[model samples]
Target: MSKGHDFLITVKAPGKLYIAGEYAVVETGYPAILVALNQFVTVTVEESNDYGTINSQQYKENSLYWKREGNNMVFDNRDNPFHYILSAVHLAESYAQSLNKTMKCYHLNIDSDLDSPDGKKYGLGSSAAVTVATVKALCRFYDLPITNDILFKLSAIAHLDIQGNGSLGDIAASVYGGWIAYRSFDREWLKKARNTFTLNKLISIEWPQLNIELLTPPENLELLIGWTGSPASTSHLVDAVGLEKAEKRSSYQEFLDLSKNCLFKMIDGFHNHSIEIIQKEIRINRELLQHLGKISNVEIETPLLQKLCETAENANGAAKTSGAGGGDCGIVVINKKYATSSLIKEWKKNGICPLNLHVHQIND
Candidate 1:
């Protein structure tokens, strides 16, 4: 890809589900399996004559400017919510300068479908998706090749730079656009780079100890998502878990080991397409999550979610809350014959809206 005249670029990135490994992944650095949803956060970019501006109808703003110091951005006066978008622009511009090319200032617009008709977010990793989409839009605007590894690096850094949490499993799934088994980046190494390296060096450096593997789940595997009609703050849940881990190290470590074992078995089951293996391992994973919630005093599974999971299990499927899990959604997995009539009825009776979400397949 090569830069030329000014052009408008629109990039869409899929939101992600934390299918397995949430809090444990942050502290223990174990692999987290995530699935990209069909829903997306969209970002549009093109050349602008004035100082850079970022807009978002969904975010209810316009003309969020990108002001900068020598290399870093001046985020003090501008709005805080668009920090991810601003970070992406700075990173891309810095890299372009590193290549001895000047980056033209651009206008950026952001949008997402992870929200409800009434404007409630469903905890679908919209921040991560937007970060990835921002990078994609900027790269395409500047005609940069968005290789998988490079995309991961830019998106992960942008997300982490603003949010200050997340294992970047969501970033990986959003960038890769499919199901993936991802391990967290080595933060010590990345932290060093963050402190000293220029944005140019950050983009060119070879990423060490980062692992991302594409996964192909069985064709007969089925997933059902039920929205709990409640919005959750993932940051709050993550912080609570972090504090609990620090206070109760041994207990947190025990839960981490158990969940890691469950995730490995689940991955193996996916590879072999063994229904029994997947079912048993998923059930074990659910129980361990419950144990974690109790020890940490975080409501990993709300009552509605528990009802949803229990109902699915009664219908011979395994289920659990998909993410940080205060009340966003729960996921159920089963065979192709997952026409669980009783489970569906129970979910409806409990006020959970069955969402029309499914696993996204990456395009070749």
Candidate 2:
């Protein structure tokens, strides 16, 4: 444990899910609305003595140390689980210097709620959430001007370094904090357009609140389950898909297009607040992900996951594995009336765990 110092900054970054449009958003430039789930990565920074220390509770055995080199901060990677934090802090320090301010060294303590206490599935956007939190804390610590756009870009850049290939949607949702319609293709265009709209004008904007229910599955749900067992690195997966397309795999192109269409339909459903439409769109999107080679492995679509979907379908609800899908978590949207007792019993009987998530608006 490290002693606290002069200034302390805390930031909470949210997890995200791409409800629609899997692989297509990267190529065709469509907009995807990623919902910010309640799960978060929290970072707390406190200024220490001249020598900076970075302590993280998330990985109990690891810590980070940084030494100021000229105007840059250099760190050793052996003890750090989060190198991106160092990069973000350096960037924040540089930005502070440009504004004629001195950047203070600090001891940082980070704790994450990314994994459930019971050791359940790893949800989507944990890495992105960490990146966002680190950048947010560093900005506050350095007293840098952090606008919504600047925060979004910095988090996205840090995430790209970690995940290799990421749609800026997750970082944007975490930074912006709500149900956001993120168009990476026209992100700059949207930002410029948003600038022209005044608060009075923005007041007329209609953003619908989605009805989201998080559940824990019953033990019987595990009967048909198979764990992909191995974790699929997101960067490697996306790069493989991209290379296939570049090599002129016509099927890959078609899969990408279908994925984009499915995403559009899902967003339209969300905008219209049509649950039936959204359900159908999710099924279509999942199928497209399977076609795109994103969900090919058995671990990606565990037997338990398939059974849950089947059971939900039989019970008038629809479920699918969300996020990067390889042995992480799954999301189910069922009739609100049946979400609690019966469905939960079925899930628990099968040994599947469910998480409770609340969807809320993000403040800029």
Best by lDDT: 1
- Give the per-residue lDDT digits (tens) of candidate 2, residues 54-91: 77666666777776666666676555566666656654
Estimate every model's Cα lDDT from 0 to 1: 0.80, 0.61
Clash list (residue pairs), candidate 1? none
The best candidate in terms of TM-score: 1
Candidate 1 per-residue lDDT over residues 255-335, each given as its tens digit: 889988888888898789787787787788778888999999999899999998988888888888888888998888888
Error of 1 at 348 (Å): 1.5
Can you give the TM-score per candidate against the true fold? Answer: 0.92, 0.79
TM-score of 1: 0.92
